[model samples]
Target: MPARARLADENVDFMSLMSEANRRRVLGKSTPVVYPAGTLLFREGDPARVILIESGLVRVFRTVPDGRQATVAFLRTREILGASLIVSDPPWVCAQIVIDSTITDLDVKTLRNVASTHIQVMTAVATQLAALVRNAHRLVALRSLGNITQRLAYDLLERACQSQLEMGRLDAMVTQEGLAASIGSSREVVSRAMKGLRAAGIIKTTPGVVRVVDPVRLSDTVRAFLRPT
Candidate 1:
């Protein structure tokens, strides 16, 4: 709870849609849950509970036909998870939060109660749901996008290292195998693209971490695959 307490005290703006008052109000009643690396926050078919990320990361993925799990998306600080439950049906995906992460668990009723008094909060819910839809669309679009490698790269950078990307190891909850699953390809192909990026001085990889040494060049590499070659 210290982490979340510190966050609330700082009053740093994240979740742009929610006002500071509403954010604090929600966090006030929420219970803080901490988990270590590889902790499963929720699994496919589990009931979704409203979760506010105070710090750390959560990876959303689904099991595939080949007995491999494809990493799909992630949730970070100031972001809300299980937002879709507020506006639509339940989610059927597994989520793994990053190491030593703290998340505030709040139920749907409390959220609804708060949002009822605050239309702005309700608007935030709407935006969150819409973002989920867009992510799904991008997931489907990845398969159709030619040059799966480039598509993979673009997807990796889409939100892998959000907001504060720099020339250092990317602490993203993604990997080659996960990337293959996201773009509907094999790890071999994903690895080749990773190698190409490294050769081009755009990125460097070490085990599970990827450092974006040159963001502009990396974007150019992604663009190259997007256009007809």
Candidate 2:
């Protein structure tokens, strides 16, 4: 069996999910707050609250049974953390500020009120929630079932797909340490996987960037990471 990348639509973020007018409307009803690095915005099992990142980086993670935190995803400017909260049942994930950031809190009650008044907003939130769930399920599978190499391949492919192009290549702006954390491996292990990828003409790397020169091959590589259950 071959590994394949998920559909592009499965990668929806908040800015991508909402229209300009809809975004403005939501933001208008939200309160922006500045948070410093090391701030834990929310913790696992905590009630969900929609937080829109206006600037800086946020690391979303979940605590495993061993009490170690496993990286879930990173949220950046214009991305919404706790988007799954829009649905009745949200996953238990904690969000921490990786860099000093400004976030807009779209109070759940306020969002509900606005959503009730606007069908388009409700539709967009529903769509975003559905995609978040699908992506979450895939992430869980990759973390639990994939090997180090497969996990590394999938991480690079996912980040590349979300990044902008440079010289016809996709640059995933993440450090090896970040990759290690995201993939639940040591930095050395991730470095070895990266070396293999580079040797195979799958990627090129700089200090804090991984450029995918062959996305088709990377995509095919990721397909080998997961199988239908």
Candidate 3:
């Protein structure tokens, strides 16, 4: 997307709802920063700092005792970075840079003060937490699906709608390994699923891209997975 379009897509428009003083408070206290792809922003026990994404994406995950990492959720531009600090009494999970992204950091205390002064800011924070919870729930639910392909198709369709991208465009960018990790499956499983979709004429796959050809059938397959057992 164009920079202008991305900003518009991510903009929360808090200024319309917040008082000038509150807006100034946040802007004045915020510090701009950037992270290259794969940088670890914060660990599980690290002190929480309020962050707002200026551009790009980040993934939140938990490191298992065995040292395996499972993706918890992904955040994009205009989304808050340290959400665990916002909603929880303590830090919950680690956040890392999934893509080269820019962010603005603000003291959590400053954000709390702003939220205190603006009901809209408080509501925005609450809505963000609700979205996080919903994503966590959806990841858990995806685990029961028979295979990685089914889970990947569901995730792509859902995220495309969330990001307002068309299905074919979404498929063109999503990778098999990324899809596998998102659905808690192996890359081989995801690859096989892609092959199946290709054979059925539901999608076409290249080395790193999969293009959706039959959205109707894909939607039907996804719907069937959601039907009452």
lDDT of 2: 0.69
Among these predictions, the greatest lDDT belongs to 2
Task: Say which prediction, candidate 1 or candidate 3, comes out ahead on TM-score.
Answer: 3
How do the residues 164-224 of candidate 2 rate in per-residue lDDT, one tens digit apiece? 3122336789999999999888999999989999999989988999987765566456445
**Of the candidates shown, which would achieve the greatest TM-score relative to the real structure?**
3
lDDT of 3 by residue, 7-97 (tens): 3233333334456766677667566788875577888878767777877666667777886666666666677756446545744677766
Ranking of candidates on lDDT, top first: 2, 1, 3
List per-prediction Cα lDDT, in the order shown: 0.63, 0.69, 0.62
TM-score result, candidate 2 = 0.56
Query: Distance from true position, residue 180, model 3, in Å?
Result: 9.4
Q: What is the TM-score of each candidate against the true structure?
A: 0.59, 0.56, 0.60
2 against 3, candidate with superior lDDT: 2
Angstrom error of the Cα, residue 73, model 2: value is 3.2
Candidate 1 clashing pairs? Answer: none
Q: Please, what are the lDDT tens digits per residue for candidate 1 over residues 1-229?
A: 4433333222222356677888776666667878865577787878778787777766667876675666555555666777767667767787775435888886787777777888887777766665555555555454566476667666655534331222222344577888888778899988888888888887777776676665445545454432322
RMSD (CA, Å), each prediction: 9.8, 9.3, 9.6
Candidate 2 residue-wise lDDT at 167: 29
